[model samples]
Target: MKFQKPDFNPRIMPPKLKVLTLEVEKFDNNFAGVCYKNGRRYVIDGAIPGDVVKAAAVESFNNITYCGLLAVVKPSEKRVRPKCRYYDSCGGCDFMAVGLKDELAFKTDYVRRRLFPFGTEVRDAATEKGFRNKITLAFEKTNGKLNVGFIDDKTKKVTDVSECLMHEAVFSDLVKALRFWIEDNDVSIYVPRFGTGTLRFAVARYLDGQLLLTVVGTKSLPSTEDLYKKLKKRFPKVGLFENVNAEKTNEAVVGDVKHLYGEKFIESEMLGIKFRLGPDSFFQTNAAVCGKIYEDALEIVRGKNPSVVYDMYSGIGITSALFSRVAKKVVSVEIVKKAARAQKELLSENGISNVEVIEGDTEEALKNVAVEKGGVFFVDPPRRGLSGATEEILRFEPKAVLYLSCNPDTLVKDVEKFVAAGYKAVSATPYNMFRATTHVEIMVLLEKIENDE
Candidate 1:
């Protein structure tokens, strides 16, 4: 039988396309729709909850499959028309098509599910539309023309977005002007493939009617001086900066920054506290929601009446300054030296003598802090969450820990570690800080249990 077998070519057969009708049950953390078929789960992008769609299996792994929505057989009741013209292509807003109420509910549910057995209270964003105070637009060369927009989700290509609904109207106006300037001047657009061109990213931050605009490129542009003049004339209260990043990396801001015009930093006030924001400073995008978060956190600290509060990963000491208003003494630990200097300046400007800024890593800075029994630790760690600092924080065995987190997964993990260390989770509150996006901010209050093994 083997000798008589005929030669066959596998390449002659076409791959079978598995298309199925899927009824989306809910949305996952990444805003992808979850559906079940044949006792296996499938995640389909571009499909909302309650959507009955025709989807094709794109890939399979283990017992799960990923799919692409081919057609919407039935749309969800929560679905609404997205405001932005580039919603289909732009990857900026994932829940733009869903109603605001539904979006908030989903975000709250998502956080609650991640932190199960912990009671959570959800708060909607103060401003649902035009809430973003900062916008960073990427530039790509397409057909010898400069396209400024976000990278597309499905194709991973740069999609030309003229306007974004989430950003302020001023942001769109600035983008229009920048696009015109690039086209009129025939400026070189950065193409990573060819390793040629100049401009890479345009970042605009709005605060207190002032705009801080940063033009990022590989090298200094020859027409920057002239362009700055034009831009200043157009936008009266604009601070222009040039950031040169020639390392061939994906970073937005890099080496050799020059303040071309206006002030070196933009001044903004949150909850009656003034903050000087530079090009690299970290500030929440939604000012009003951030104020709410700070108010809630301050309330938690006020209840404890801690003599000393340790603000870990304190950026520019805004929260630390706020803590100084309640706590007797506040110790702020930051990794960035420049930010620590800024924090010192801000504390002086605000006449806040209680907060002492320490420029070092949190894990090392904790060693020098005198951890009293009634002391409280307020940690606003990065998205990666607490690392070795978690152990250091527990070593203090403070009265309470107020942890603010942007990533719920890491937040839950850290909370579990705290629980294991004899700390009881008192309350977990989720805030809709980043609207229209799949991001949620959680503030958890943990108190040490007495006589725990």
Candidate 2:
């Protein structure tokens, strides 16, 4: 069912919500719960398996529905108090009520269950911990003062979250300090009304105990120079500073960037390869787990060193570089022009001459590359799964295809399609990248059937 429908009424609950007892079966991901309500299959929220919770109807759209906890009819043995104070209202995290260790286990199990339908088990999956590296908080004004927090679920109303459990303690402190800094300077918060103002967003990255600040606004901020200078003065170890003016109505930071402090970008090492990350480039939030994920992807390309490797949806080219080292040639396909350009620059700077950046849709770009008789194809599509065109390209058949997905439901659906297209599922590896949340990332390796034409 499409989640594009209008918001559910707050007063009207879903029908049969009260009578149905939810036995949380498994977690789909953050914001979704898999449970059997009233002896029928149902996806519930605010309840997990082994927790006998009295769930009250919250909302229902199409076939999917949401419920709120009315009483703990029963509690899971592994359940624990959420660490953040914004657990109830703040929408940043959906698994705050789950224990860290148990949450990881549940995520792993979610992947395993999804693969069960295909008769594949993820055996070598790792439970990566302490891997959260980045987070984006909404910037809004509350009580006539600038406040940094996440918006309530299904609403633009800001929810004040002083403490976010996903981030390290220092990062949270930076958010607080930033709010004070903006308020003290009397800078106007960029309101979305006709899109005219400065101070739209403040995204900070914590690396090596140093923060890289990127301030975004609808219009250029006049005080950006002074603000950067003051922030650097207060925090001596600030690594990089940038100001981005996104005049467009979208949330993405797409504008002329001014390097207020430090170099144009900062360098971070991942999977033994160097990556250049600017404020605009996309990188995995959990860096350490990403290293393992990259390693696993490399393992799929082991021994059978192909003449060419196609890294589809190559985000910032991290995976592209990793595969380039082993393959005779690697071609990275990405739609974002800026990120593709950054990948090109990084490849050139690192003296990695074997890789080429193709800026376009993966499905279209892959058709242009002349893959040798035995070449590998790696596709990491978005949560929505592969594009229809990309799916058709996969049907054309490659030696081996490595499918990396952050959502199991979509992964299962896509894998089923691959299996139907004469691809054999050789292996699947599940990883718990997001702890204390239902999110799980998986790597699936499939090979073309010998009988396939």
C-alpha RMSD values across all candidates: 6.2, 3.8
Looking at model 1, the pairs that clash are none
Least accurate stretch of 10 residues (summed lDDT) in model 1?
1-10
- lDDT (Cα atoms) of all candidates against the true structure: 0.81, 0.70
For all predicted structures, in order, the TM-scores are 0.92, 0.85
* Residue pairs clashing, model 2: 24-49, 52-74
Total clashes for model 2? 2
lDDT of 1 at 54: 84
Please give the distance, in angstroms, between residue 195's alpha carbon in candidate 1 and its true position after superposition. 1.1
Leading candidate by lDDT: 1
Model 2 — TM-score against the truth?
Answer: 0.85
